[model samples]
Target: MALAGLKVIEIAGLAPAPFAGKVLADFGADVVRVDRSTSTMNLDVLAQNKRSIALNLKSPAGIEALIRLCEKADVVIEPFRPGVMERLGLGPEVLLKRNPRLIYARMTGFGQEGHYAKMAGHDINYLAISGVLNERSKSGKGQVVDAAMINGVNYLGSFVYNMNKAGALFQTPAGTGQLDGGAHFYDTYKTKDGLFMAVGAIEVEFYKLLLKGLELDEERDKLPEQTDSSNWPKMKALFTKIFLGKTQAEWIKIFDLTDACVTPVLDYYSMPTPTPAPRLLRTPAKASASNEGSDVFLEVGGHSKDILAEAGFSEVEIRDLVAKKAVAGAGLEKSSL
Candidate 1:
């Protein structure tokens, strides 16, 4: 609702760019995804609340159609290697000139200029070069990195950056950092049922509460100091043994509404209703009913004719373009095209 009137043109790509577009669409922006003529993966979840049009950018008519679409768009989100759009004559300079107020957002792995700019990469590769992956590496085995794209963006903030500038952010192996499972109170523990519970009782009072919840209060006096790195392994072992004695749900019930800072590690299918973030008292985010029918699941160019007509193309012109294979969509009879 906050972005009800905003118009966004998102060039279809992989996870990160699509995710950004999804966020805009979720907030009520009129998002049109410019998809390639050929379909890729089935990304129905990411396609929610958006329209898709397939265009063959290599064709002059296709490029012109895109430029016309940009003429009415407030934002263009392009995710490609450097110079790809420029080579296609649809780069920022060309589009921005048509709509001077346009926000041309270029999302790329290595950025527009650099030695790695043209290099192919995924989320893991991006994190690998940024020192993050290395910190989490274990015995040289590559683990699947979850949400690394968003995490990489957050790593640019002040805290980690300031530490790096002070030359204090030394590269440490996995499970060694204060908040990276080095301490017993700030790690995940397996429960009796084989499920896991996340423990983030970082503050003194919270740590005390965690110990109390675990019925380890009597041993707290004999326990090693919390900040002493040498004591972490023994404390972690103690915590692990105690935690495995109870199920995750049992632990959650014990720590709920308390200061222990504990919660169960939820899987995707088991995720509960999320508490709305940003805590907006008004204009809260609402999920819209997805467009119905198999037509919504049709590959990229599914809405080609409609999108073309909306962009000021006459019915005849749209048909002509489709006949020339400059655009494609489902159910476009030759007579209509």
Candidate 2:
């Protein structure tokens, strides 16, 4: 429950990358957000509950300050194009040498090395490349990138990215390790009332219980049906259909009762219980517009300090960073979608 004395340094940036760091921070990591000195990120949702130190990574002093900060950090997260950090002279090699055990988490749309590594991207690109985006939107209209619009739209929505990064922190091979290289029993299914439940289990009997609880006909039809190794496709399809048929609460009723691996989908405002995701914990439900402690990083590519610094800068930054330059600070003003 507590990361205790662990220290994390997040290079001020976007949602998923920073949210990953926020998760670590909440559990007691001393998370220091390295904000761009000229960053107008006055209301960063992900960076809340953490400390902020503005530094112009483009400046030699700023980069050195970061290196000094890294010397005391256990992890440093950055979500730049493959070489942006290296180009800024703040790459893993420099930081790792200073802090050998430091988890140098490089968050990217594509991975460290790939055809798209150097290219700019977001969750959409990562999901699209892995075929997850396509798979999520393959039916009927066959949207080109609904995953891009929904899941791939923000940093936190990139569950694959966060899970992978968290894995690397706990595993060996240091920072270059894989994030998604764990057990493969991840799944989501629906209840009779049509709500979806995400499932994770390694035991065969657990999987059987899951299928049985969901009343998957295809799974029931399989021979030696009780075995976990039975073809999971039919059941998986049934699960997809069942969830698509109902709202999330109806499914939670039955799913939460069974010992089967399952959990209902929840959003920021609709957590079923006392939750612990970082953003939720740090943000004050009723904060003054001028509350000094709240800060979050809004990453925008292609800008110099002079351009990014100005009185109207925060609003302009918000607009440019968010949809059509609308300055919705930290999304607090917007109703939950």
lDDT of all the models against the reference?
Answer: 0.76, 0.54
Give the TM-score of each candidate. Answer: 0.85, 0.47
Number of clashing pairs, model 2? 5
Compare the candidates by TM-score and give the number of the best one.
1
What does candidate 2 score on TM? 0.47
Q: Please write out the lDDT profile of model 2 over residues 1-337, one tens digit for every residue.
A: 3566777777766677677776776576766666665556354676545665555566665566567667766667786766788888887778877766566666666556656656776545655665332321234221111112222444544674575578623354423222222222355555555444677744677766665665654335653343233434444455577666766676666567676777775555665433344344444232212323432333422222222232133544433333332222233125232
Residue pairs in collision within model 2: 16-155, 44-296, 164-179, 194-246, 319-325
- What are the per-model numbers of colliding residue pairs? 2, 5
C-alpha RMSD between model 2 and the true structure:
15.5
Model 2: lDDT equals 0.54
Question: Which 10 consecutive residues of model 2 have the lowest summed lDDT?
Answer: 140-149
